[model samples]
Target: MREETFKKRKPKIVVIGGGTGLPVILKSLKEKDADITAIVTVADDGGSSGVLRRSFNAVPPGDLRNVLTALSEIPELQREIFQYRFKSDDRNLDGHTIGNLIISAMTDMHGNIYEAIQLLTKLMRVRGHVFPAAEEPLNLHAQYVDGSTQTGESKIPKKGKKIDKVSVTCVEKERPVKASRKVISAIMNADLVVLGPGSLFTSILPNIMIPDIGDALIETEAKVVYISNIMTQLGETEELNDADHVRVLHKHVGGKFVDIALTNIGIVPEDYIEQEINEEYLLQVEHDFKGLKAEVPMVISDDFLLLTEKSVYHNGEKVAEEIFKTAFNSQRKIKKYL
Candidate 1:
C-alpha cells in the first residue's frame, strides 16, 4: 500500500447491540473518525416496528431508526421528521412512528430493509455503515420465571417475570445475514471490538445468537470489550447486578466473555434515586467485579451518570472517552510484547 493510502485508512470498529445504547456509543465513536460498522439486532416486535413487521413482513425498523438518528449530521428538523409519530382516532394510524412507516415504504420500493437504510444513510450523510443481524423479521422467544413463554421482544419485558433465556425464531431457521463482506473484513483488520451498555438480553445478546455472527466475533483477532449498563431494566433485568449481567452474556455467547469489562461506578444522587423509585424503577446493584470470571479485568469510572430532570443515564461522550482510553492502553501493552 502507498504511504498516502496508509494515512487515509481509518481505524475499523465493530459495535454490536441494538436499542438506545448502541446508538449513543456510535454517536461518540463517529467523532473519533473510525470506520464504524454497527451490527444491530432486528427482533423488535413493538409499537410501530411490530405493526410493520407483522403486516408487511419487513425487518423491525425501530433499532434501525435509532442508528440512523445517531449517525445523522443533518439539521434537527430533518432528524425530528424522521422520528415523528402519527397519532389519530383512526385505528390505522394510532401508534405508528413516521420513521417506521417511511422505512417500511422504502423497503417495499427497494425490496430490502438493508437497501432502504443505505439510501437513508446516503441522504443523511451518516458517518458509518449499519447492518441488521438477520434479514428476516425475527421473533424473540423467552422462557419466563412463571414457567410460561413469551413470543415477542416487546412482550418479554412486560411479563414481569425473570427471563431464563432468550432465542430467535422465524417461520424457518434463518441464517445469520452475512455481514457486508466489508464488515467482516473490518473485523479481521480491527484493533478492538465493543459490546453493550444496552439491554443485555434484548439488545446485545441477540446479535451473537446468529450462528455465523457469533463465529465471526469468536474468530476475530480483535480485543473485545464490554461496556456495562448503568441501571437495571424494570422487567427483564430486574435485579441483575453488573456481574450477573456478564454471566448471562457469557451463557449466551458461550465462552467468549470479554477481555475487559468497563462499568460505571458513579453514585446517583438520592433525589434521582427517589425519582426512579417514584416511577417504579430501581437503580442497578453495585457490581461485584471480584466475583466475575477471573480472566477479565474490570475498569470503573465515576463519570458515568448523567443526571437530568427527566432521566438519569450514562453520558455517551464520557463513556466513549473511557473506552478509547482503555483500548489504547491495551494496545500499548500488546505492542510491548510484540
Candidate 2:
C-alpha cells in the first residue's frame, strides 16, 4: 500500500541535458521527491573524459558521474570523496577524477553503459534514474555556416563559426548504439519535460538529435519547457536572446514543440559579470518577452539568478520551484480531461 501510494504521488520529471548545469537542477529535483530521470549526453570529448574515452575506448563518464553525485542519497563527505581527483606525482593517476575511473571500470565490468549506470545507481543510492544519451561514446558532428564540418563536442564551440545544426554519430558503428529505450519511455511518461540550463548545442541538442529520441519528443503529450541559459555562451549562442534560443530549438526539431520557455529577469551585477567573462567566458543572457511570447505558448520570466563571489548562475531552488508549480498545474489540467 505504501509503495502504491508513493508511486501515485511522485511527479514524473525527465531532464535531458549534460554538463555542469544538469547536476545543479537535478540536486533540487531530488529534494522535491520527483520521480527523476536524467538523460545525460555521451558526446563529451574533453579533458579527462576525452582522455579516458580515447585510451580505454569507453563512453565519456564525466557528465554521468556528476549527475550520480547530485542524486545520490548519501552523506556529503562520501559524495565529495567519490568526486575527488588525484593530485599526485603518479602519471597514471594524476588529472583523473575518482568518479570517472569508477564509472569507466564499471562500464567495462557490465560490458555496456546502461547496465553500468544501473549497477552504480544501486551502490551509490541514487534517488533517481541516470541514463547516457547513447550507449557508446558519441561523436558530435556540427556543420558551420562557413560550410565546414566539425566533429567533437569540445571542438564545436572553439571553431568560432556559426553552427548550422548539430547531429550525433556513434563511435562504435558496429555496436548498434542509440539512445536507450528506457530514456524514450521516461519521456513518454513524464508530466513535465525540462530541456536545459546548459549549453544549447552540445549539451541539450545532442540528445534531441538522435532520430529515435527526436521522434518520441514530437509525439509525447508532456509539456516541453526550456530553461533559458542564464548567460549567452560566447561562441555557441552569442547575441541570442531568450526567444531566439527557443526558435533555434524549434528549428532543429522541425516543429513548434516547446510549450513553455523559462527565463531570468534579474539583472546580474556588472562586477560579477566581468569575472564571468574572464573565468567562465559567458555573458549575461538578454531576453525579448515579445519574441518569446509570440513563439512559445507560455513564457515565464523570474529571478532565477544566483549571484556568487566566483561566478553567476541559476538558483536551482528557484528554478525547481517554478518547475513544480508547472507540474501541479499540468496534472490538474490532465485530470479535467479524464
CA lDDT, every model vs. true structure: 0.74, 0.86
Candidate 2: the clashing residue pairs are none
Q: Give the TM-score of candidate 2.
A: 0.93
Q: Give per-residue CA lDDT, model 1, range 171-287, as digits (tens).
A: 354653444334455555556778877888888877777666667677776777788888778777877877788778777768754777778777877767777733535675577
Candidate 1 weakest lDDT stretch, 10 residues: 329-338
- On TM-score, the leading prediction is 2
TM-score of 1: 0.88
RMSD per prediction, one decimal? 4.0, 3.3
In terms of lDDT, which candidate is strongest? 2
Writing each residue's lDDT as its tens digit, candidate 2 over 1-338 gives 86555446767788999988889988997888577889998889998899899987888999999999999988999899889988989888888899999999988888988999999999999998989887888888999988999999998999888888998888866654478748888887778889988999999999899887887788888888999998888569888889989888988989888999999999988777766634435678898999999889999998898877666778999998888778755642232111
> For each candidate, what TM-score against the reference?
0.88, 0.93
Where does model 1 exceed 4 Å of error?
Answer: 1-9, 145-147, 173-186, 277-280, 293-295, 298-300, 326-338
